[model samples]
Target: MTIIGWMIVFCEIAFWVVIVLGLMTRYIFKKKQLGIILLALTPLVDLTLLIAAGIDIYRGEVATTAHAIAAVYIGISIAYGKSMIEWADQRFQYYVTKQGEKPRKRYGIEYSKHYFKGWIRHFIAYIIGGGILVGLIFWIDDISRTQALSGVAKIWSIVLGIDLIISITYFIWPPKEKGISSGT
Candidate 1:
């Protein structure tokens, strides 16, 4: 893997690590302020990745798949990071701190709604990430240097389409709840 690839991996690891530390501090150590501060730092991790990608492109390095992925990662993180953190916090509160009820699993129409919400987040990620990729392409001003970014955009667009279809299907035919009869 290239340096950018390694940086992407590092950023991902750092993002999760920060979240875990924040939650642990809040729930385990009872240091709520420090935990909030740590949780708030998730954006900084994304910013760092963005800066690195920008610098790499600015320095005339050919953009690679890793670079394109970095943009996508930032987009997804921005779009879903809060929900993800909330998800973890809920689980931690229920399982670890025993302060809250267990997070309920959605079923039937509720499950479909959950899927739709997830699809919306994915759409937001595509827009943000695609915009960044286009910006990088324009900034590079060289087709050869930006092919990887373009490819990533195309592939991500396809994925977005597929996600939408899947999300819609959940609404069209809501998943049956386990052990529930269909009046057969």
Candidate 2:
């Protein structure tokens, strides 16, 4: 198998482990699942883009496979971030209703610091993370990559690093809530 092929196998294995571990934590513990679900799907997202981008890379349509992978990571980060933000909003609404407070209709609010996260924060975070990934890819592609495995490894590491960093940031630095802000 080619270096690219081996790299794919390595990533797939890593993703499978993450998926299983996430499932165990979310399901067994009956935990809030939005973030865990996103974690589980990262590998699938990466795999899909790698296959698609590999073709373009071979054809020289993309500057490199890394470029294609970077684009895919950006897309997935945005989607996953949006989903988690929405889930948190809905969850907050449910809690408010249960507590006999009027739930913010057609908008979100931070009832508490823990519950006061904003979707726009997620949006901005994803944008910044994606920007970093794309920027690095562009930087790296300036040099010729003779060893496909090494170049692919660099790409994989970048994507994985961004994923970890973004996930941690969201987990640790969740958005602070303001007044029951509604969209105009």
Candidate 3:
């Protein structure tokens, strides 16, 4: 395995560990700032691994299975990082600050509005993420542009389909009511 390959392994481990520890620190230990800092640093792990992979490819290494997997990882992280972080933040607030019994939706209207906004946000993210991946496809020498771009397109389409299903389900079976302000 290449150094980049090892870095990907380390990064994947560190990413999840950071999330777990961050949640533990914030929720269990009540160290919000420290936990948030750690959580915010999760992308840096991905970034480091990506840079290492780029360097490896630049040094004339062919794109291996490891590199392709790393590209997929990086692509997802880039595309969904904002939405994932938002979700975690809301979950933290709902459980800890609000002391809510659960994180499920309370009202239909407000929840619909929030869900629509999230869909829009994620749509924009997909576009930006796709563009970035296209750029990176150019940067990495051994990867096939057509294949990678096609893969990215498929990912975006899949995500879109899932989001649509969730939206329809939300319309059909809305959550029980709390207050308008508490839907987050």
Task: Specify the highest-TM-score model's number.
Answer: 1
* CA RMSD of each candidate after superposition: 0.9, 11.8, 6.1
Note the residue pairs that clash in candidate 3: none
**Lowest-scoring 10 consecutive residues by lDDT in candidate 1?**
175-184
Over the stretch 1-184, how does candidate 3's per-residue lDDT look in tens digits?
7676688789878877888778778877899899989888988988897788677767766655566557667766766776676677667667766753556654776787677667776666666555655665676633453364457557777977899788777777666575435437
- Report how far residue 95 has shifted in candidate 1, in Å: 1.8
Candidate 2 residues 1-184, lDDT tens each?
Answer: 4444445455656655655455445444556475367465754646564565555455554244454334545444554544653454445435632433444533122322233233344445445445544554554574454233245545555756665565556456544456634345
Total clashing pairs for each candidate: 0, 0, 0
- The TM-score measured for candidate 2 stands at 0.30
Off-target runs (Cα >4 Å) in candidate 3 are 1-10, 64-72, 89-101, 106-111, 140-149, 154-184
Off by over 4 Å in 1: none
Off by over 4 Å in 2: 1-39, 63-184
User: Which pairs of residues clash in candidate 2, taking residues 3 or more apart in a chain or in different chains?
Assistant: none
